[model samples]
Target chain A: MPREDQGPLLEFKAVNTYYGDLHVLKDVNYTIGRGEIVSLLGGNACGKSTTMKTIMGVVRPTRGSVTFDGQPIEKLATSERVKRGIAPVLEARRLFPRMTVYENLEMGAYTQKRGAQFDEDLERVYSLFPRVKERRNQVSGTLSGGEQQMVAIGRALMARPRLICMDEPSMGLSPLYVEQVFDIIQEINRQGTTIFMVEQNAAMALSIAHRAYVLQTGKVVLSGTAAELRENPAIKEAYLGELQVPAAA
Target chain B: MTAVDVYLQQAINGVSLGAMYALLALGFTLVYGILELINFAHFNVFMVGSFVGLGMLELLGVMPNDPALTGLTLVGVLLLTFAVTMVFSGALGVLIERVALRPLRNIRGPASMITTIGVSYVLFNIVLLGFGADAKNFPSPLPQVQFAIGGAVLRLREILIWVISIGLMGGLTYFVQFTKMGKAMRATAQDPDAARMMGVEVDRVIITAFFLGSALAGAGGLMFGLYYNITSYVIGFQAGLRAFTAAVLGGIGNVPGAMLGGIIIGLVEAFGSYWISAAWADVIIFSILVLVLVFKPAGLLGRIAPNKS
Candidate 1:
């Protein structure tokens, strides 16, 4: 994994956000480098999703700046941010319910305009989630939770984004699907696309993430390398509850 | 009138009336589908179209007695009314969007609904003050040609109603299915946030929806005036209510559904008036509404889904 000193891909400088004066995200400062899988770990209502949403321009920060590709994107609209290759798969896999799987994929490539490359993107999405191809004519609303997650991720990938933000991807998934989703995130990172993920499962998230940040009540309480966080006593007590030490052979 | 011939005549009249209702309902449904807001002021837009038709007829100097050039002049009046009403109603739709709907979109739903109702009342009173209480008779452009088909006599106005309504509906369907902008409108209707994220100018698409819907209502108004040969400020309320019911019956937001609902309601009214009793027309229509709601709450062609918790 690349060091944080190597210049980050996305930088949030003292960003603050609010939900109608509730002051949700407070002075959030974080960086995710290119080709890295960084996870934002926190319990519910800890501003983990808020951080991701702020970065995606869904929740505009009230103070400070967010820079993507070394340009300030704080004032840009969510769609403009998306066009700049920053895609987000929101929590709960909000797919267009009435649209067919193929149509849902086509909507993902909406920014690509009508061109030859649009077909190429569809092919790539189909290749990533072959089940989507099998059920191309099926409406997205009928898909299982795991399949919907796959469609959501695949849809984001179709945008040809340099960075993808995933919010609570493993919320209601079975353990096996959770592992599969994590593997896919790692594979996507291996393919050179950066990932900023918000996850409730701290152990699984830190296992794959190169770096991680722990948020509590709209503020970052902890930040370090994955190994350092895994070894931290406080993190173990707060997240893992009881540490499992391997027996001596 | 013979039993079979009267039945045929009523059916023809019902179908023609239903065609007009279908046109109006379609306009209402399109706007409702996209915006999820009831454009109550649309009724006045329709009435304004009739008034504009009256103005055009007067401009052409085709008095009620001048039967010499009346036929050609009536055609000019129809075209003129259609053009003027479309522009005027289109502008009114956009204005309402900008002034009332847009401002209140971010507000709560109830507030917006009440605001729209208020706007509707304001429009009604304004027209009443301008046009007064007397009903103005609209001069028909086409001669009242009636022909025998089987046992029933068909009126030219009735034929014109079908031709115009069906033609507009076909054109609209083609535009929505084939045009890029129409696709964008549908996309926006489905999911505004996602549509915006996909770089669709959501506001512009919304404005376009309003324009198209209002234009259709304007055309329907002109046709209604031509067929009924009467116009009044208060006429909009009855038409608007019936059209709203038609839209609801046709699945609220579905375009073709609105047309179907309109035609069904029209037939019900006509048949009820002819065979049952004219006084029971509304009761029959409302009964159908209750039946539709009880069985298919989503209306015809509406896809049912699990209710979101």
Candidate 2:
């Protein structure tokens, strides 16, 4: 559990979500501090994705409050939530397939007032994903998986979000691409953007996460600093499985 | 009739008819583009516009034989019908959305289609019951001025059809290409979920689309009444079906395609009816559709990639 004095940027107070009477997320609680990289680590069917969806307002919680920046966003519409600087890079890179990469980014800045600020935001997105700038006119659907993922992240960043909730950025990507994505995530966090990520790759996630929560069966089982969670025996046995050999040896 | 003169006359007539078809087809395409569901009740909205025009004429006490008041009365009736039909039909679109569509949100595609067809029949019967079965004659607003162009005759009605259709099309094109709201509509049509995430009120944008589309259909209906000088309960059904066919032929969800398809269909029908046989006009059009489908199913200007969910 995080200390009470840490002052969370986002706090979910016992969130309970249901999909037509089937309990999906049961009494889930967690917090991420401002400018922190926090990962919700879990295996499949463990409600990690559900937690992200709930925060993004894609799925509403039946019983709980999701407070972001001291404002409760539980009842706000998904679009309205987006306008308030809360953006989510959904799993599977949910891009507007027919639209070009640049158009997709412009869409992200849809909520922003139409002016010079919007143009500056587009430039920032292009700068962050230089590959996207190279292929600005390419249709998002035709792009490679890694490139598409970059477009998704770039699109979200166009909103100039206070917090970005990413759902499995490493999924379906090659190892090199995975590492690149992680580096970008770290770079973004270093630039003072708080990130809440849901990842099955616990080892990599824990390495960068300032704080982390291990979720099991719709509930949080453990919470601690990155180093503490890395050393935890339960995570090692279930997620890490085996250690790599030293290069010198 | 001399071959060249007959051809020229037919071409002029086809152009006028094409303009009206394009106007109506735009409504069909715009609605279908935004919402995947086909609004069968759109036809009834067109029929309602005719009724509104008739009501306006009656209120103004314009008679078919009264030449003095006919011109002024026509303008008044057209404006009154346009305003009333737009608002009323737009409300009908909203009502259909809320009552018919909202409840069936979870229902799959085929079922929604059948439900819309059922709604269309219900609207047809209601209009039939309200208005008598007889076809009512509408008084013409303009003096039937005819001009000879290259040995072919052209009427004032034909000229009005071209001017109105082109003017409206240009206005709509400008609106869609330049306006902020139009951009929002296009974005929503492309991706509803992404549009919502962009802070676009998807439902409101859809409502605006419906209002604009239905209003256009209403305008077409008033023009149809003026040109044909008759209105009937079942008139919208045939016209609606043709407009829908035009929409499909041009590419179901493409706005510009609808216009192109409508004009093509009009020209085909006119040429077929004049040269071959009136009985085979529809058959020829449908055959053309089959050929288009087999060769290029996406229609003339359709996007190559399928829309992402």
Candidate 3:
């Protein structure tokens, strides 16, 4: 549990998102405090990605409120949300493939005008991801999986966002690269950027997350501290592919 | 002129003609890139721009008395005409977008095209009613200035057309490649949703694209009046068709492709008229378009870039 001193950076209170009549997200609620890694874990079609989209204002909630930095932004447009410092690294690394790596980063800082802070943020991103610096001139599409992820992260960091939402950062990476991604996520969190990540890799997600939520069928089935969830029988059985407790089963 | 000299002179003529087409073609491509609309009204807007230039020239009045003074006055008037026509036409483009296209934003693709085609008719008729159907003799201020390079003899009008068109194209390229707003335009074209996520005001970018493109077409209209020394309301139909074809040939959404496509079409028309007959020139050009469509849908320089999500 985080200390009472630090306030929640993002809050989703009774957010119900729908795609026409599909009812994609059903009264979901979660909170991420400042300087914490909060992960949403679920299976295929379980609304993990929808949750991220709702945060970015790509999907408006039907009957709930989403407060970001204490402002109700449920009715705002995606571009307006972005200007408010809610940046997203969309599913499968949505870097502008036709653009150069450097150009992609510059685009991430679109809300900020050209000035000293823009340059400073760019330098900070380069220092955080040296591979991105070396491949700055290369087109984003040609980059390998791990390197592309670096560009995605570097691009998000360039915005100087209060919180960065990532979707499936480990979805298509090699085992070695997966470990590197998790380490980088922790490093990003350590540097005072709040993270709200959606993933299917529960073990990896829980390992670094300060607080974690396990969703099933568009609803939160389990939510607790990372340490508590790490030892929970339900998570181990459902996510880690372990034996269920006989009585509970 | 010898046989080679005739061909060389035709080539120079082709280049000047193609420069005007390039500007019109570039505008068409820019609109297509953002809105995915054919923008048939742009052709009529080109016609309006020519008329606007004529009106400015008339308003400025003809140079009187001293020959040297006439030269200076003509230069001043032409410059003023260029500035006024481009601004007037650019504003017209914005108006067309607001009145004819903006409300139809959610309409299916072909519906928008049909609407623009209707707008073209309305604008063409309006101009015809005002200016009358007869072709007006657009006066040339310069007194038959001529120069020769090897076998090819060139006129001052042709040289001026080339210089102005090339300068405009260069400026446009710089604006798109180096400026922030231009990047936003490309981003919006690629994926408007993703661009919105990146905090790009896609509507503004679309409007800017229209303004820039219409301005180029307006300048082309001015050049067309100067080079051909004639303006008719119906001229837009043929010119627009040719320029639209040029845009398709260069890859509808590609900037450089539109330019190259225009030049190629111009050259083909010129050479075809010389070698075959003036009546056969359009046939040859259409045949080339058919060939390009059949072989390479991406056009010469167009690389099919995947739309970002």
Using lDDT as the measure, the top candidate is: 3
Candidate 3 accuracy as lDDT: 0.85
Q: Model 3: per-residue lDDT, tens digit, B112-164?
A: 88988999999899998987989987766656778987768899888889888
TM-score value, chain A, candidate 1? 0.92
Per-residue CA lDDT of model 2 for B119-196, tens digit only, reads 778777887898878988876766778999777899988887788788888888877755667767777778776677
Regions more than 4 Å wrong, model 1: A1-7, A240-249, B56-84, B143-145, B175-180, B294-309
Best by DockQ: 3
Per-residue lDDT over A1-249 for candidate 3, one digit per residue giving the tens place of the 0 to 100 score: 333445677888998988988998888998888888999988999999889888887788998898877778899877788887888887788777677898888889988878999999988888888889999999888999899888888888877898999999987999788889899999988988999999888878887899999889999989999889878888887886654222443
Ten consecutive residues with minimal summed lDDT in candidate 2 chain B?
B62-71
Clashes (candidate 1): 0
**What TM-score would you report for chain A in candidate 3?**
0.93
DockQ of each: 0.39, 0.56, 0.61
When only the first chain is scored, the TM-scores of the models are 0.92, 0.93, 0.93
**What are the runs in model 2 whose C-alpha is more than 4 Å off?**
A1-6, A133-139, A174-177, A237-249, B1-4, B57-84, B109-111, B294-300, B303-305
Pairs of residues at least 3 apart in sequence or in different chains that clash in candidate 3:
none
lDDT tens digits by residue: candidate 1, B1-309: 678888888889888878878878877888877777787877777777677667767776754434533466556666666777777777787888899888878776577767777888887788789889899877766776789887898888888788878888998898775566776676676766666665567788888888888778878887888788888888777777777788889888788899888888888889999878988888888899889989999887664542221
By TM-score, the better pick of 1 and 2 is 1
